[model samples]
Target: MTTITSAQAYLVDIDVETVRTDAVQAFLKQETVFVSITTSDGLTGVGYSYTIGTGGRSVLQMLRDHLVPRLEGQDSSKIEAIWMDLFASTRATTVGAITSLALAAVDTALWDLKCQRAAAPLWKVAGGFRRDVPLYDTEGGWLHLSQDELVSGAIASRDAGWGGAKLKVGKASHREDLERLLAVREAVGDRFDIMVDANQSMTAAEAIRRAHSFEPVDLFWFEEPLPATDISGHERLARATTIPIAVGESMYSIAQFREYLERGAASIIQVDAARVGGITPWIKVAHLAESFNVAVCPHFLMELHVSLVAAVPNGRYVEHIPQLRSITRNEMAIKDGHALAPDTPGLGIEWDPDAIDDRRVA
Candidate 1:
């Protein structure tokens, strides 16, 4: 067997047709995280990780400065040790969107390498849990979207075959958010599943207040009502509202997610594979959430999450945000509405090398 060798980073602007904007923020530009890992025998595996708007530079810096040094000239097969090294090196930064963003890149690259070596898609290597996960269309739930726009988007999503759709909430006032949600509910009607993402904008009282207002609507779940750190707040919101409190897109590790689960903080768990270390940790999260009988609805990376959700029994929905269409060789397939996973080697995440050639940060 060949010993592990070198790792390098590349900064690419994955061209997207449009910037995905919502109450959270805007993409502003096309960007992605690309990593190359080479073994002693000359077998190189390519992996991918990405961020939406901010933190691209930080991801590159972390890899160029802190992470690559530890992995260079080491056995790539020793994944666990390398993961530990990276985790410890960045521990001082602690876990947040930033740390998790960096880990997402490295972990993704490593998984690509592993899949290439084993000659299997990520779903198989990670243990083929399922082939079909429930799908939800994220119809660009922008903060700027008017009530009419929100209703139209939801109906369009339903018409397109999506099982549900996520709408943005958390404006300046809880009452305002309710008015918008009610309009959307009236448009989409009672049969469709309507979820909401507050994007960490509300205080606990506001989250509770807004949640109660949506009770007549039969909401699918309430997402990111408050900061990920305030576990007690989330628990309070969960207990106070009949609506399910869903979190974990900003959370980075199993330990953190375990805390959410232990506290009964979330009824619907939205784990981001990129944010929660990588496929390894993401799978760990899915299983842990399953043990508690919590629903698993992974955040973003719909192309990646489709496969993951299919493999996990409790997996719920893969968010469908069609922003990576220009850069990816295979844009996630949408039939009616559910996003379909590609049956290809690795993650089925091959980008147009030439399209990324003109990528620019400035």
Candidate 2:
């Protein structure tokens, strides 16, 4: 057995190019928690998770003080068993962000090691459903951007042959949101898919009202209109809207996804591997969504998500946001509106150690 001989974790603060705003908050920075593990045989694997701004130190501490020690002497190939042990250890925080994020870093590192051992790429190792998954842009649209900026960005994305682009909703006035949507729709015409995300900022009633207002523009989906935990509210809004309801970024567990899926609260699954405890539970949630005939369009971390999305039959779209560019050597492979999964062995993140070291926080 390949025993894990050593494990280490660190925190790095990544700067955001612009003020990323949704209805609830502005993204201040990205605090990334990176984990690396080495086996007795000398192979090494690295993985990471993130917080939009705060709480990265907590995740790093969890990995170092609690999770890393437990990983010592464990078989690196026993990914599922290791994950379960970690999950059991963090029972009190099983369904929370800090625990899940910590687990994700460790779990992903294990998978990377496992894949490296087998000499296979993660998409093939996971399932190999497709080499390419469709791409959509979330970076182009922010709630704080002016209507002209929004239109120009959408047009640029469309001209570049991206499948679609997302727009942030939840302005003070519903009419303002509608007007922006209309402007973008008129600029891009009916061919381009436009997804609207409110970032879980509305009441169920407000969501339902906004859904109706957005209907005429031919929106691809209305995302996170209400809060993430409001299952009943989501169900009501889902029933009231014709546009597909996309959610799952704020969700931390498969059980929470089950609750949403069972009640028909979400039509599109936006499960985040970093938040859902890495590729292990992320796959469970994806398969669960598949069983329900729902599409999986994961949120953020496009570099890692592209491979996972391409690995699953039900995987739909990969959100385009280049948050890790400075620290990674390769960019996401985008061709003809779709992202091609990396053929390299392991998770495919080419970490620039010097870059990460330069940005290290704690």
Candidate 3:
């Protein structure tokens, strides 16, 4: 029996590669929280979750004060049981970001151990549908960039063999947004896929209007036009436009996703593994999206998500927003414009311990 012996959580702050702006907020830094779990059989697995800028300490505290204690002496092989136990332990904070993020940290570590124990890479262990998932560049598209910059970025991505590039929308006027999308569309040509995101900055009515205006560009998808809680609003927007509504990055529970799917509010699901809890529930959400014939295109944490997106048949494009390079020794493997799932065991993230120590905040 590979019983858990101990769990340790660490917090590290890594600056964003560049200025990352969206309709709602400017990304300050990545406040990454890492959880390392050791088993009785002398094995350790590392798992991590992140906040855009703040809340790392809160997540760390959650693990130290609540989650980690429960991990001691638990069976490392029982991933689902342990996830449920942690969820039940934090019942009061269930279905919230901090709890979910903390749970993800520990839950991922367990999965890392599970994969290592089996001597299989995560993509294969999870359900190897494909080894290489399509890649779409999001780092080049930010609300802060100029129109010229956006166009150049899209062209660069397309020329580099990427499948798509996502542009941040929600400009001051619908005309401004349309102009930007049109500029990128003209530069990238009709064959290259272009996606637009509002970062949940508009109302249902405003989103519908923008969607109609953007129809000429043939966008791949329209993402997060309204706040996550507004399912009815999303439903209205979905019915009002031909563009597919992509959501789930802000959602913290499976129930929220189910409601969106049931009401036909979303076409593409952007469920973030950290926000939704961990790989355990992440896979569940992917399967749930599959049941509805919706595609799973998860948001951020691309290093980890590359394997995840490759794990399931319904998985779509992996959004490229590289934020982990500073603290990690390896870059995600890419070939022919696709993010390849690492064949190495145990989450496939090569953490530089010295670099992590240098950035460690708690």
Pick the lDDT winner: 3
Per-model lDDT: 0.78, 0.93, 0.94
**Distance from true location, Cα of 183 in model 3, Å:** 0.8
lDDT of 3 at 276: 94
TM for every model, in the order presented, reads 0.92, 0.99, 0.99
Model 1 misplaced stretches (Cα beyond 4 Å): 14-16, 360-362
lDDT of 2 by residue, 1-362 (tens): 99999999999999986679999998989999989999998999998999998899999988888899899999999999999999998897777999999999998999899889989999999999999998999888999999999999999999998889999999999999999999999999999999999998999999999999999999999998888989999999989989999999999999999999999999999999999999999999999999999999999999999999999999999999888888889888888889999999999989898999999989
Q: What residue runs in model 3 are displaced by over 4 Å at the alpha carbon?
A: none
What TM-score quantifies how close candidate 1 is to the native fold? 0.92
Residue pairs in clash, model 3: none
Least accurate stretch of 10 residues (summed lDDT) in model 1? 15-24
Question: Cα lDDT for residue 357, model 1?
Answer: 65
Backbone clashes in model 2: 0
- Tens-place lDDT per residue, model 3, 39-112, is 99999999999999999999999999999989899999999999999999999998899999999999899999
Q: 23 in model 1: Cα distance from truth in Å? A: 3.6
Q: Kindly report which residue stretches of model 2 are placed more than 4 angstroms away from their true locations once superposed.
A: none
